[model samples]
Target chain A: MSILVDKDTKLVVAGLTGREGSFHGLNNRRYGTDLVAGVTPSKGGQDVEGVPVFDTVHAAVQEAGANTAMVFVPPPAAADAILEAADAGVELVICITEGIPAHDMLRVYTHLRRDERTRLVGPNCPGILSPGKANVGIIPAHFFSEGNVGLVSRSGTLTYQIGNELAQRGFGNSTIVGIGGDPVVGSSFIDVIAQFESDPETELIVMCGEIGGDEEERTADYIAESVSKPVVAYIAGFTAPPGKTMGHAGAIVSGSKGTAAAKAEALEAKGVRVGRNPTEVADAASEALA
Target chain B: MDLLEYQGKQLFARHGVPIPEGRPAATIEEAVIAADEVGYPVVIKAQVLIGGRGKAGGIKLANDREEAERHAKAIIGMDIHGFTVHQLYVEKASDIAEEYYAAVVFDRGAKQPMVMLSRMGGMEVEEIAEKDPTAIARLHVDPLVGFQAFHGRRLAFESGIAEDVIRPVGTMLERLYEAFVGEDAMLLEVNPLLVTGDREVVALDAKVTLDGNALYRHPETAELRNTGAEDPQERMARERGLTYVKLDGNVGILGNGAGLVMSTLDVVAQAGGRPANFLDAGGGSKAEEISNAVEVILANPKVTGVLFNIFGGITRCDEVANGLITAFGSLDISVPFVVRLDGTNDEEGRRLLADADLPNVHVEKTMLEAASRAVELAGEAPPEDADRPGPSAGADPDADPEQ
Candidate 1:
């Protein structure tokens, strides 16, 4: 019933013995996700949160048939983790680590393109969640309600905030995704939107974009020509001055391009209702679902 | 970080790339001393990060020591592109027989490291690329293949490099790539890569921008951070492990995520208020971090009001509330402050703030209502507790997940 993951999905936690990986692995387990195995180097016999551990993703996959991998490895080792998961033949890989150098991502992205079996979500993102069914990376599951609308965002807390707002509006979500706010990431808006478009359970799409790159503008181009469902969108950083990065490495206004005004204009031209704020965005989505 | 020309040349020289002998000086006396030591006919160049230094008279030829001193006096403390020049680079000038361009930059469209070369090179290279794109020969080197001898040969041949100088130019290209990879540079450009009378290929101008994300591994490169060019709040935030950006407004804004903070700025403006700054306490911010962010924003004299929009995910709303109370203990905050808490542990956070009952602190149930209240209180009108919930307020039973 979700765009990317659901009840059938079996998950493995990479770097499961590390502080972040183990802590969040237990959290996902508590939320009733199918977190069946863990991976850590040279810790093959150890168990975290009662889940069996292996030294390599391939071993975990061979034993548990895990199809998805949630990576919490540090920046230097994150690329290798992603490649190793892909090499192990996982269907989806989500990396939650931040500050991986862009060059490292570039090489990993190059290699991943040649391998057709896997789809990657983020190296600096909060991973995807199918509320009440599966929790992948760190999103608080209790804050959401199960329903038809699909949400994707480039931010962490903002994704939770909007999803919680929709739940508070008596609307439920099919899937909520954080695509990360880095310049180079595993997935893009168009990639996630295309999936949402095909999921029959997803009646509408809610996108949270910010000032940076032409990703949103490029997504607008894709929606104008192909998307049939009503999409409510919000773009952040209108008051942001040119040339200053507003926290995210990718969320910056370079020269005159990638301005919030420019992004809003692009989305509006595509017949999408662009909300001025979070509440306006939720109201727009609610109205469409009605 | 964009290294000034002197720093870039130093990096190039360290990497075995040919560059003119140069020394940086902060005063006219130092410039004259450097020129005397290096001999006459030196070039006095102002050290500034902005472009068009030559057009703005930041670069001048000194035929003698007197001219070097005079140029240094005029160039230092001179303003170009709003940057006040504080240092002068005095170097032994080169006699350029010909000029070409070479660079290694990450091309977004190609998704690879690209080596660019052109016969037409100089300050006008930007114009050349924009107008006649084909004049530049760009090669997107496969990371696996990397910059190779054949790739260097292709650049040399395609850019119309002279037959006698082709090998030297190719060598320079390889060295440039080495410098780019070795320094973890985002951009390495030698505009006007000069061929001298002695047939030596040298970098006439060096400009390198290091990847800030990769600086953790290169602590030596990290020391090259231009503290003089950094904003005080920006430098402080970087040291404190907080993401902060200073804006030209009066409303002090703080939030949990970058996206939420950015949206807060836009909404605050929509509600007839200007946000003074952008401060993201980050996911799961602790009490000390919350107080540190508060101190940072309160330090801005233009702030007439403060807005705290925390959507607790990894960040606990109760911790943010306690942090706010803790901040009041050590600081003097007279302006109106509004806090909106939602997501995990929100009600507990709200209760913590309400029980404390700090003066000039108000909590609204929704993000929009909170922003509206903050803007209202920032002006002459005081916020009323009667407007706790709006018609579309998310706290209604159907919306509340617990119900």
Candidate 2:
């Protein structure tokens, strides 16, 4: 079975009245996502695409039975939105908004850690999709189809590329999770890998990561210790020069620890198939599957 | 956005940080006037948005007005790290009994604003921290509580500042933190926060980086943006709603995808030519977007050739090919262009380009071949060295007079 989301997973669009929220919500519904509720303060009782609207996530969850929450709030209010959703007992929260001031996320991250029941995906992510089951964020739905391989990534566009490559190779995906490109995201690579490892339908997993953070190192350690599943990884920022920040806010390797070379070496040492090129990711996965 | 030391100090001075009186001068006359106002023993520093200016001969200590004027004249026209200086900051130099460093920056690990303090000042705190991290004191400030007196006092004590001076240092740190957070600053640094012989601390230098995205909140900060220091092509790209950065290379790249642009650069390098710049025209781009991208690529003097690697799914291949034609027609692009269009309407894309009848343009069947061709065109030697050095004979000064 796919992890985090499936066909029956009921979802609510928080801040759905906003531009990105409304656009993505409509796209999600068009892609057959079970978007049952919409949440927007003062715009309650209104409907977007026939979905019932509620003032707060709590009321929406109670009335519409929505367990998953997708947020498109702006940076300043993003942390509060996530915390409100968590307080309302949303089982899963995916934040698509980027550029939340760093200090704001730290408080939210600490709160999420203390609350063990809630699982959050991103504060600067594209969200996840279990192909043929549900699409949560902005990833093009047609590029993904139901299959045995699971994919997880910290990049939005790279996730799309890997999904497209897999679809072209005739291998569909069980789930594609965008853990987001923020340095302090809701979940880490190791956390998603743990979920993929336990999924029975996920025969092989592809992990897409960028430079910066010790998340890859942690994932390598976890893979070495307990993981037996065939894993293929493609790490970005290899050709990138040292001390330059990339497009992603989280993707900067200033200190000695977060270099692309170091991450690639760590993944390779753990027997995970490491692909250097984005186009070669599918080939590496194909070999891993073989 | 990187701010010059004088600009950063302006913000610091507004936030109540005790800074030496100074003014940025565009000419030696202004420098002399500023030096006269600040009194003798002034320091003349080149106003450039680069680090290590002192080592690059951009900073000089002047004992008098004439010395300050001479130093300003020398520094104003100097180039440091590719940035030419047009202005000099003349400030009252301070006597240093002790030097301490302080900075406020976002810590990714802690996911919060952090203040770093060190007794070892005037030097790069990074090196000092690497050698002995214990010598530096780090405090994570809660956004709600901010940098209170206790936080600053703790840092001051940890950094080994005297107990009596802790209150003043604490006040300074608190104000600096307020400025850092209030200004939406990415980095706020005070290098060589000099402690005078009388035990008074003053900021001798300031460096600040403002978040570009948050500039809308601070109009004053947005006004401080120096467009002259930026590449003309980059400014054009920004005006056209494109993200472009000029690099030292020859092969020009135009792609919709950031990942694709990066891969194109790597492929170009692998194909034996460096990339002139990274320009993302962005997805679902139209004819105008393509023309803008072409303009940016052709603007780079180093770019000898151009490559368009379009993978069309939502972005139709024929549309991109038509855009290329439109761009070529509008701009006088003399550089050779190599294109590889794949996906939707591929044959139609090829047919459209063929119909354009453009010279110096070649369509490739694969990305690899297109990259290779672009590299080859870029590797061609220049027609002539227009700015080459003049020929000089080895004649003795005694014999060469009047001859």
Best by DockQ: 1
The lDDT values for all models are: 0.85, 0.80
Please report the candidate that would top TM-score against the real structure.
1
Backbone-clash count (model 1): 1
Q: What docking tier does model 1 reach?
A: acceptable
lDDT at A75, model 2: 80
Residues B1-403 of candidate 2 have per-residue lDDT tens digits of 7898999999998999998889889888999999999898999999998778999999999998789878988998888978899878998888888888898986655556788788888888766666666778888887655778889988998988666677888888999998987887878989888888888988988989776656767899899987877779978887888867666667888865555565666677667777777776655678778887898888888788999887664456788888899988888888899998865577898999999878989999766688889899778633433432222212211111111
TM-score of 2: 0.88
Across residues A62-155, which tens digit of lDDT does each residue of candidate 1 receive? 9989999999998888889999999999999999998888788778888887777898998788888898888899888888878998999999
lDDT of 2 by residue, A66-121 (tens): 99999998887788889888999999999988777655676788778878878999
Reference-based lDDT, residue B194, model 2: 81
Most lDDT-accurate candidate: 1
**What DockQ results for candidate 2?**
0.23
| Residue A9 accuracy (lDDT) in model 1 | 79
Residue B220 displacement (Å), model 2: 2.1
Please report how far candidate 1 places residue B55 from its true position, in Å. Answer: 3.8
